[model samples]
Target: MSVQEPEARATAVSPLGTLSLHVTGASGVTIDVAQAQVPKLPEGMAVDGVMLICVRLAVQITRESPMRIRATADQDGHPETGEWLESMAFANGAGRLQVAMRDDAWLAARGVAAEPVQYERQGFSQVIHEAPAGTALYVSAAWRIDCATAAGDVSAWFAADLALPA
Candidate 1:
């Protein structure tokens, strides 16, 4: 009998002008999300005169029972000013999730030019924002299902670079 190697999977690339989320969750659990639109600012109110791109993720998890979830952002080697601006929580049938952003002063101190765009993904969610060049931002989501009978999480880091024209 001859042994055959499995075919290599193709690498997926994120769409231009958008952020992508990768999630891992409990076995037998599934999640789905819709791409979020960028936040709209009032007229004459620009993104602090700096270019920015934001993405929101809406997530839904379907499982047999309830779960606990938490999400956080990790600034990759970037100086943190220790501020949290907004936070909100909500619950669906079997789980709960909260979303938030860093304080304006902290963001300003780090030269983060705009508000974070928040969204959800399979088994996790995310918020993307504009940061200074050479800086990196990390996002993480943790979930516990059936009161910790099964649990998982995902974290991702993205580095800031020159913005491409839309």
Candidate 2:
């Protein structure tokens, strides 16, 4: 499989320090992952040997000061052949999040007319993974924050390991 960049993502103005990920129990940060589901596509819309699962996450960044945050994911399950999906960024706050998709043929075979990154849900964004059946998904959310403080220009990360039901 291949990953494609739909558009150029924004970068932190003054990124500094080491990148970090704040999971549950981390001060002012909480991440909630929804159940993984193998979505049912329309009739004749499925690609042969390609299984798609939707992973949803709702991350609340309750820091007092606002900063620009960006989100990206890596298919850690297969590092060597891992895919680097598209990156999503929020202005002064975290907004929608979506990973990069496979190659054009992979998408075209599934009858996708355009890049599927324009949709957003109530407070969460869809992260569609193209993993083989009976495999676990290890998605790492690499977050970059651009704070105005001298000591606050650092990147952080939070990992979500979801076991797909066989």
Candidate 3:
């Protein structure tokens, strides 16, 4: 995508209210919910009555500059600045999970450098077990773009009621 106009903000939401992402300022970034699911675990890795929230983020950063981005997912309250989940593995034998950005040739061809990344979590195990499905949970992401012409901070989040599979 092209560089966002300075101070401009954009928001996109999934059709089911399962998740969403947005951005602000001239960071030249956009976010979308690529996937949101309660993944099925392998027989041994499964935990009775427990479920996990996995969210894949489609992020595009077009501005060429070093940037620092942080992402997290959890229950109830919004994630704090320090609660960064840059890399994490699911609990209870649910295998590994991560949100990593890669170089995208598609974006590169158009002059953008970074590929979008996904976000997910089992960090709210207690909430999963205790709260009924449809309770609100949040996924937070923030970015600090450092290009000389577009130095600013942009943040995004998703506040969705959990949709647990039957």
Leading candidate by TM-score: 1
Per-residue lDDT of 38-100 in model 2, one digit per residue for the tens?
Answer: 234434322111112322223222233211212323211111111233222222332212222
Question: Over 4 Å off in model 2, which ranges?
Answer: 1-83, 93-131, 144-146, 149-166
lDDT of 3 by residue, 34-112 (tens): 3343344434222112122322223332343232233333322221221122222221122122212221333244343
Candidate 3: count the clashes.
2
Alpha-carbon TM-score of each model against the true structure: 0.28, 0.23, 0.24
Lowest lDDT block of 10, candidate 1: 151-160
Runs off by more than 4 Å, candidate 1? 1-83, 88-90, 116-130, 147-166
lDDT of 1 by residue, 1-166 (tens): 9754211111111221112333332222223222222234334321111112222212222333212222322211112112243332222332222233344355457654433433333212322233323333322121112322121111110111112111
Which of the predicted structures, 1 or 2, would earn the higher lDDT when compared with the native?
A: 1
